[model samples]
Target: MPLNTRILLDNRPRGEASVSNFRIETVETPPLAEGQVLVRHHYLSLDPYMRGRMNDAKSYAEPQPLGEVMIGGTVGEVVESRHPRYAPGDQVVGMGGWQQYSVVDASQPGALRKVDTTHVPLSHYLGAVGMPGVTAWYGLVKIIDPKPGQTVTVSAASGAVGSAVGALAKARGCRVVGIAGGPDKCAYVKDELGFDDCIDYRQHRDYPSLAKALKQACPHGIDGHFENVGGMVLDAVMLRTNPFARMAVCGMIAGYDGQPLPMANPALILINRLRVEGFIVSEHMEVWPEALAELAELVGSGRFRPRETVAHGIESAPEAFLGLLKGRNFGKQLVKLV
Candidate 1:
């Protein structure tokens, strides 16, 4: 029997998440039943949303259960298969969680998917051409619909979702501005990702300071925004928003640690007539095909290569995830389980 090592949610966080909240265990990988395939994970995606799921609170999705495999997206290859549709050695993507291997029921519609890694690399399936890319597409195209000559901005701009948002907006003829933590990330956003300008939010601590920086960067004012970080970032963006600006509230990572993140000015939404909408991308599964096709083509063409910060082995997932929450990661954070 194959030994499958996985991390489980051991306890709920009080305020901020800690590595102690998780437990790692190794168990015998069960034999695949009919219509099941065994996936050996190569790369495991670590995202900010997982932090929110750690708390036992009312949320859009159920709180991650105690003593269960940590929920995560993984790209891997089938090592054993009982399903006729899935053959051994087939590259696949699925919610294989924080584990070295998973026995997935391929019978489910979206349970296991074979992917083409020729134009796009296998790892890209977990980042650029996968959920994050689709997330960017939904936010940019469906929610914060930008027009030519308009200015579109994104927070956490160098990340998987934010970088794609900037790229797509730039292709739409919109001035793309990004807000990131450090100078290196800001530079990558402007130079590499083709963003018009990128503001280093770390340099500007207070609201006025950041807003001043934003105003300087966005000369025409922000017409649309893809918000990943809330609190100060959102507040600063709101102050400089143009009339009837649209905001897609993808994530409020600032408030993920069981804290109240009140908006500095709720009145601005009314005054500016901003169409601010919070969304969970999974809810709109209907758009995935359209979104993925466009994203994959962009990645395949080499227009944008989403930067990644990878940690080796499953043991590193906790520390890497902690680093991500502290804004230490440059882009997409992942664990190379293989």
Candidate 2:
């Protein structure tokens, strides 16, 4: 029997997550029951949302159980199968977690799906063409719905979801401004990702400073926004939004540390008459097909180029994930298990 190396959540973090919060162990692979298939994960996605799942608190999803494999999206190949729908060597994408292999049951809805790596790379299914891409599509297309020539802003603009949002907004002929951590990310957001302008949030640590930079970048008041880092960034973007503007609230990474980070200007929501909406991309599964098709096309045609920060081996998953939360990993962060 093959040994399966699994990384489990050892301790819930009091504030920011550390490597000590995780535990890695190897065990003999469990036998697959009827309707189960054995998958060998090649790549595991490390996303910021996983940070929210770490805390034992109320959230959109259940808290990640302690002593279990940390939940995550995995792209893998079926090495063995007892399920009729799956066969040997079939590439798949599923919630395989921080383990080298998973025995997924076919009866689980939306749990396992086959993927074709012929045109798009297998790792992309974990990022651009997968969850993050769909997340960008949902927020921009469904929520913001920016018009051509309108000015739109995105926080954490160099990340996977934000990068996609900027590019898609550009395709729609909108003036896109990105708020990122530093100069290099700002440069990549503007030069490579094609955002109209990029603001380095690090330079402007305070709300007033960020507001000034945003004002300079967006000469015209922002008409739409894709909110990623919620605390200060949201406060800054809100100050410059036009009346009747739309904002899609995606993630509030600042408060993920169990801090009660309040909005500096909640009144702006009312004063600007902004239509702010918060969404989880997974709950809206209806749009995945459409979103994936368009994203795959864009990626395949070179119109949409999604970058990645690859960490080698399953053991690296914990450190890589911690880096993602701190904005250390550029683009999409992934652990290459193979």
Candidate 1 local lDDT, 1-338, one digit each (tens): 48999999999988889999999999999987899999999999999999988988788989999999999999999999999999989999999999999999999999988999889988888888889988999999999889999999999999989999987898889999999999999999988899989999999878889999999999889999999999999999999999999999999889888778988999999999999999999999999999889888888898887899999999999999999999999888999987
Best by TM-score: 1
Pick out the ten consecutive residues of candidate 2 with the lowest summed lDDT. Answer: 254-263
lDDT of each: 0.92, 0.92
Instruction: State, as a TM-score between 0 and 1, how close model 1 is to the true structure.
Output: 0.99
Error of 2 at 185 (Å): 0.8
TM-score of 2: 0.98
Q: Which 10 consecutive residues of model 1 have the lowest summed lDDT?
A: 297-306
